[model samples]
Target: MTPPAGYTKAKPGEVFRLKRSLYGLKQASRQWNKELYALLHSLKFKQSTQDYSLYTRTQDGEFLVVLVYVDDILVTGTSTSQIAAVKLALDEAFTIKDLGDLTYFLGIEVHRNDKGIFLSQRKYIKDILVDAGMEECFVAPAPLSTGLKLSPEVGDLLDSTPDVYRRLVGRLLYLGITRPDLSYSVQHLSQFMHSPRVPHLKAALHVLKYLKGTLDTGLWYSATSDLKVTAYSDADWSSCQFTNRSLSSYAVFIGSNLVSWKTKKQQSVSKSSAEAKYRSMSATTSELVWIQGLLADLQIPVSLPITLYCDNTSAEHLPENPMFHEKTKHLKRDMHYILEQVAAGFIQTAHVSTANQLADILTKSLNSSHHHVLFAKLGLISKVQLEGGI
Candidate 1:
């Protein structure tokens, strides 16, 4: 340790007194990350360029991967002995407790079988229900009601006693990790977090009701599924009644496994539905590029020209079209980005019917029957259905 800036006559071997700890400083996380990176580097592990939390190493055709989140670490690879050795070294340094196989991490529960792996949050859902005091609430066929209109000022403001609306919505946001079906509903309700109305509260409770029926539902990764990457992009033009901003939504899949999905409102208003869809396609393309880099870091090969499906024919042709019309002047940059990817053989755009667009669930509220159809196509399955081989 060095002496204070004003003290220039310090002893050669003198050290500053310990008044605080590295963990007590505001830069604790950054300091810890540097130390962890040094240790992993000493072990011949290279950090991922796509995701800083991920580390990987390969020796003698055996691969080892380490995923770190703060102090919690998830290690996996092709060799059990290699994993064990890595764990042994980590435990020696940090005094870690070996939890064996990953059955539960964060709030997600992992169930494994001969078929594949199923990730769920049944317990987390139940806890949310209890916290919301909706344990016995009636179930709804879908998370959000069809043709529902929710805005900032709809009804009387909610009581400020306990802030039930904000709390429930926050938990639902976390629950959305395993329940993509709640993406649209949760994102819609979250818009009113600052000043929630009675109608907004009721709508949030409706989402809880939907959760009651799908408590056991979660993502399933099939063992036999291929590694091909596919994506569905869709948008609801001027969906917000007040702001007139469109919603951009997309779903990404690896073979039959649903890996990522999102529903977000556009920052600026789009002039036409085609523009909205094009914006959604741009967001989806960015996600696909990140996924490609991540897979490369993991030593996984993905087929070139990843397929991107959009329901709008106009948006489909925008990527390959050579000319930009007068109405599309504002979208010139986006057009160039997509056109570059298309020209480089990184993405192939195609048109799909509205009925078959899986991302429709993330854009707007739909009827019960249609919502259920898209839900099933998302590779979501309940534990009972999985056990029965349904």
Candidate 2:
């Protein structure tokens, strides 16, 4: 604490102290983070390199993991005693109230049974529906219309304020955390946040209607899931009519449990479907590598040569084939990176038929039946359906 230039008071070593909580200050979060980091380090927990928010400590062959999100912290692992100790330490230090079990945290609901754990944002979705005045909306068969192609300039700019559309898209983006089925649709609607049109607004509302019908749908983690890492990568080549950008998507799994997935438009335009698909594979490989590191930090062993499934035969062969085609000269960097991983036995590429491509749901809009089929394969389940409810 530096003294004011004009002040000639007191001792040189005297420093000003903060009398109030740092709740509203910008530096509050940073200071809190630093303090928490120091405390966790003192507890012998190693912060994960893959994710700084994650910390892990091992004692007597048991693992204790801590996940931090601002003030909300989640403690879990193989050792219950260590978790309790850590909680007590945190409470004594910061006066935190322990929320028993992990049923709810940060707006996500967790359900556990003998089978496994189920994660959902059902109440969050309901809140969104009510905010959009769609609580009584007619339920659609799917989140997106079959074969629908959204164009930025197709319809008149929404007569209502564009904030409505922007807010809806933002909420839906957060909802996608547990709802992989909404990934592609939310990604599509997000593109027009700058200047959303009437058609775009309608499509966003359609998603709300679908949400009303499948309110209980969410990812299911099976207790018996293997530790094997498998990933499915796909691309909708040149899918955007206006930008001509291809959509790349991947679904990553730890055995049969879906852990991570993404649907994003490619930043650069690809000349061929193979190139687009290859780019998608590159993205998926990066995610797979990160997941492997994170699992290792958690003391979980993942087998090598993680299977990466792609629908394009050419893309699948690009990493293994020695000869590079003239047309693929532009993708040399991507090819080299993928090949490096393949050579080191970090990942193995396999050709999967489009019909069996689970990531197809993330790359493009599919017919109702096809969408549901792929959705089922993505490890999404509905609690209502399990209990024989419509």
Candidate 3:
């Protein structure tokens, strides 16, 4: 609230009095966040520790949840009467406008039916295509070219501004929120944000071509989905040619519906493939602990000893092996954290064949047939495509 120059009228020795300016104040956004939190808290909503923007209330067999994202508010409850009452109360307090059930939020589109809910960013992808001048480009079968290896100094620099490359990659990162299929490709492209090369831009365009034909494809949340959690962890050892770092990725499921996924290069190089796979398993176990905590907040009971599948047999037995210190002396100490969870009966490890591993799609590119099979299993069903027999 510092006053602008030339508005003060006083001697240097005396206090200079000036009008306080509220324009562009630092507390604007912070004050707004506090105001929203206080208003929701006054309505008996308990804020979530895992995610501060979420608030929940349960009383007399009625359950309600409110999620605030800046100025936008999403309110829902199990009881229709209770939801209506809350909407009315919020509208009266804030003089707000109610946008019915969430058909669209941010840039993603939502459609629901008897089977489940589907989320897609078809419009967003189309907009990106137009911006990149690829509206009539050729279609492809997958996001990245098969066996394509990208490196920091592999190709010539783009004649276009580096800012342009950074912006496109940034948008693709957000697009991966619902498109788990794009997780690996986007993460791979993100590595060269500082100095993008021709190979990287070409790889990004390949992803756009794949999206061209599959615009209707989206994540499906089955209405019958339960709280049962299952996860698959996988890795590609030394995939990064530049740094010799392995790629680690895992996918989490709520019953049969895929809910969470991630793909990242391992922080350190592993001496053996088993060690790399073990690191991936540790990451998956850590995510499960957090997921279970969130489920607890929702009053849903999670059935454990939760099953974790890994394609590598050694990594599968690493947690239960009593002599891990002798066999894996070279591996990082953090890799043994899962052993404690296994001993506590909170986790169970199982062996899964490479062909059946869902996390495979998140770690590396696959053939057209293989990609389609995993895509269908991940619940990326397209209602429009199914109806039209595409």
Candidate 4:
């Protein structure tokens, strides 16, 4: 620790004393993390290099996974007796609360059954709707209306209570963690957070209405999943009216279960649609490589040459061959990382029709009918519908 500005002269052997632990202390979280890591290490758990909070261990064909958040611990494994033994050891070491199964964690509700696990933030969504006074609003088929174009400069300033719009948009962003269907809508509304406009607020209201209709919608992770890894890559060129930057989106799956998805604006502008698509492929490939390594750490074998599907053939060709149009040449020079992964047989590029692109949902808003089709294909479904409760 460094001394205060005026008290820089500290003897090498001098000791600093501390009082009782307090909430706002500078080292509170760090101290907690270090202590927990040391204790887990003593238990023979190896910390993950990718995520420090994650710990894993294996013994006699049984695997255990542990994740720490501050003082809370989430523990799971293949062997029931092993998990029980871990809990007993922790109870002996420290005063602990064992929240039996993970029915809910971090505001995301978990529903499990013979089918699989269903993740949703329904209570969180309802709170937002109530705050916006749209709890009774009419339902919409999709979060964003077709052909709805929003810009920072289009509409007049929100007359009163602009902060309401800002607050709602922020909450919606957090909700997207479990609701990928809301990704495009929330990302669009976030653009005008600095100075929201009337048009933007109206669009945000549309999203709330969509959520009302799809209150039970969420991601479904099946227990019968296979280890086959495949990913879909997509890009919407020049989708943003304010910045003209392309939107990149991809959905990665392990068999029929969706494991990862992303919706973000590209940092650099692309000259052609193929350029935008190829750049998106690079990002998706990076995520796929990371997932492969993590699975390997768990002793799970991923099949060789994971397949990547793209809607554009030109974008697909960039990875298959070295020579191409001006767009491909520029991308190759700047993004040789993705090209090398392909050249070494780490990934195999393939073409899929645009309608079959699961990533399309994250990149742009389609009409109500098209949106519903893609929504289900992305492994998102309403819990009520599955249970015959809707």
Q: What is the C-alpha lDDT of each candidate?
A: 0.93, 0.91, 0.85, 0.86
User: In lDDT terms, which candidate is top?
Assistant: 1
Between prediction 3 and prediction 4, which has the larger lDDT?
4
- Model 4 ranges with Cα > 4 A deviation: 1-16, 19-21, 324-327, 333-335
**Candidate 3's C-alpha lDDT?**
0.85
Per-residue lDDT of candidate 4, residues 1-390 (tens digit): 665567756776665677745678998888777777888888889988766778899988899998887777899999999989888888887679888889888889998888788898988888888888998999999998897888788889986878989998999999988888888888888988989999999999999999999888888888888889999999999887777789999999999988888999999888889889988999999899889878876778999788999999988877767665654566765358777888888889999999899899999989999999999887888877668731
Model 3 regions lying over 4 Å from their true place: 1-24, 330-332, 385-390
- For model 2, how does the per-residue alpha-carbon lDDT over 1-390 read when each residue is reduced to its tens digit? 788788788478899778744789988888989999999999999999999999999888888899999999999989888888999999899999987989999889998887788889999999999999999989999988888988878899976789999999999999999999999999999999999999999999999999998999888888888889999999999999988999999999998999999999999999999999999999999999999999999888989999999989889888998577689888988998999999999999988999999999998878899999998888889987544522
Task: Score every model by TM-score.
Answer: 0.94, 0.93, 0.92, 0.91
Write model 1 residue lDDT over 269-360, tens digit each, in one string.
99999999999999999999999999999999999999999999999998998697798989998899999999999999988999999999
Model 2 bad stretches (over 4 Å): 1-21, 385-390
lDDT of 1: 0.93
Query: What CA root-mean-square deviation does each model show from the true structure?
Result: 4.1, 3.7, 3.1, 4.6
Say which candidate scores most in TM-score: 1
Q: Is candidate 2 or candidate 3 better by lDDT?
A: 2
Backbone clash count, each prediction separately: 0, 0, 0, 0
lDDT-better candidate, 2 vs 4:
2
* Per-residue C-alpha lDDT of model 3 across residues 56-167, encoded as one tens digit per residue: 9997799988888877888888888988888887888768888899998888898877767789898898898899888999999999877777888879998677787888
